[model samples]
Target: MNFRRLFAVMLKEMRQMRRDRITLAMIVGIPVMQLVLFGYAINLNLRGLSAGIADQAGTAGARALVMDMVATGVIAPTQTVNTPQELMASLRRGEISVGVVIPPDFERRRIDGREAVQVLVDGSDTVVQSAAVQLAQMPLDNSVALANATGAREVTARQIAVVSFYNPERRSAVNIVPGLIGVILTMTMVLFTGVSIVRERERGNMELLIATPVSRSELMIGKVLPYVGIGLVQTTLVLLLGLWLFKVPVRGSVLDVYVAALLLIVANLTLGLMISTKAQSQFQAMQMSFFVFLPSILLSGFMFPFAGMPRVIQWLAEVLPLTHFLRLIRGVMLRGAGLPELWPDVAALIAFTAVMMTLAISRFRKRLD
Candidate 1:
């Protein structure tokens, strides 16, 4: 209970903390990162969801209805299609979230109280689904009045028909299970590889490794190859559990899912190896992995709708491997999208793997110094 010794110990510990610059930076950086992501980036109240319009009516009424849907601030029309089939194709390719189909008989149908507009929604995302439902229920008296061919007519009936594609049942598992694969792989692969080199250095294995004939690039690849198999195993377990427990459907080819998972696993492993190359200790490696993990989870469209994020945030999110993987997995599992529909995301993952592997190899030195 000597205050003098206790204060001296506290001061010594403070000095030690100050010397660990990475830890010090993380202490300040992690909280600020969380604040910025949650406060500005993670928005649940979604708006400006990309939409496509297939206006077969080719009339003023159809155009007016499109404008009305845009004015709701729920959806923004980004593409014009000749048929609803094209709209669905765009949805499968992850190009748009909502689709507005105005039939050629729009004026006649509205007057006769028949369904005038078919609003097709990509229901794999619940936030977008909720917004589409709201748009369907909105009272568009002005648009309906202006759209009438003869004159302004008031129809006291619902005109928009909302059709939810993919997950018509609106099951959360349908959306979550696919995304869970990416999230789990990101966490495990990154963490496992993040500590590999650091652990070797700590356990006195670096000297033996350096004495071997293996080149730095060879060493890095060797370190990552085993983890790739481990990642694939983990992905299989998660998919099996999701199917058995949640009844999550895999609509696309199972091989496609594995292909996407493989790309993600390699990309994340390379990213972790790159982190390990820079980190001085396993503790620092873990901290850095968490740093990458938080953004991957929050900004990667796993927890929030990608369309809802601010434009700049969306751009930043595009750089994360998880963002693209989620799209690939969800597009495959939920939307039944094929490689033709998901080539862009596949390319992104490949590019990420290349960049990360280059960086990791470049950063690792053969010597312990």
Candidate 2:
């Protein structure tokens, strides 16, 4: 019931938290480090698939098919070889994702109405292969129809250019790395902040902190600052890994990611702080942290594509810090977006942080008695 005693306990808890270096590191350093690694390295869009062709027919008709495939933006034609052996070598060497082997009489058969040319599509990545196969087939079909409609007169093959927009290489790593950053930050900040506060209460040190002259605002800052620093350090380390290992480009301004992540970290920490305010024991806080984490990972578009989810689930995800962070990081990493594009996410986090901190502080009740 004594205000002075409660204040003293808060100060004591602050000192103890400062002394626990590992816990402090997890709170701040981990989130930032994770943001950098997971943000840029993960991508899913496929582009410019390499392909090799073996043109046995050596006729204008076979050449026309190759030309058509090249026109489709999906395949970058590497070499036109005389035999299957040469093209197989290209495929084995990983020079192409697809191999087009034209039989010697391919054009004659098509002209004779025997059968159509066969295309060998690598099925390793069904998504990428299907896209490339579909695009390449367009020229083959056109050539056949043009030849048939013209009635034995040699059809001049049409040269079509396929342009892969956005992510031309279709690498999934680009999407994954950016999204990972948001998830890691959410995990570390929420768990660390909530658990840290609840631990003080469990150890009976909260009473001692409440006894000191340290105000509630000061105590909150003292508890939060160390974790924030840890999150930042984590950000730096992950970014370095992403740059060196994944070869992911930082096309956007570094300050953009930094500002977005900072806001997200603050929101997550504040959410944790709010939960800590409500939890009576460390175990309860841990339970609440897990409760928040499950929904966060599921609803954050990390596992299921956000666009594919039901409208209600998507709406539920809208309020999560991780969801906003994902959009912010992806915009920066993929779109090379600046503050103008990311400001909405930043604003949402700021609003969430403000509300959560206010509620936690108001519920903090300066007097335990």
Question: Which candidate leads in lDDT?
Answer: 1
Q: Summarize candidate 2's per-residue lDDT along 1-369 as a digit string, tens digits.
A: 999999999999999879765456557755654563245322234445667777778877677766776776666776767776776555433345566777887766666655445455443233544465466336455566667665853332322222232245656666567777778888899988897667786787878888899887777767777888788777777777777877655667898888878888889898998888877677667767876786787667675445334456567778999988877776666556576755666788899999898887777755553
For each candidate in turn, give its C-alpha RMSD to the true structure in angstroms.
1.4, 14.9
Shift in Å, residue 106, candidate 2: 32
Q: On residues 148-267, what C-alpha lDDT tens digit does candidate 1 reach at each position?
A: 546635543377889999999999988998999999999999999999999999999999998999999999999999998999998999999999999999999999999999999999
CA lDDT, every model vs. true structure: 0.90, 0.68
Pairs in clash, predicted candidate 1: none
Give the Å shift of residue 337 in candidate 1.
0.7
Q: What TM-score does each of the candidates earn?
A: 0.97, 0.58
Report the Cα lDDT for residue 81, model 2: 73
Residue 304 accuracy (lDDT) in model 2: 49
Q: Predict model 2's lDDT versus the native.
A: 0.68
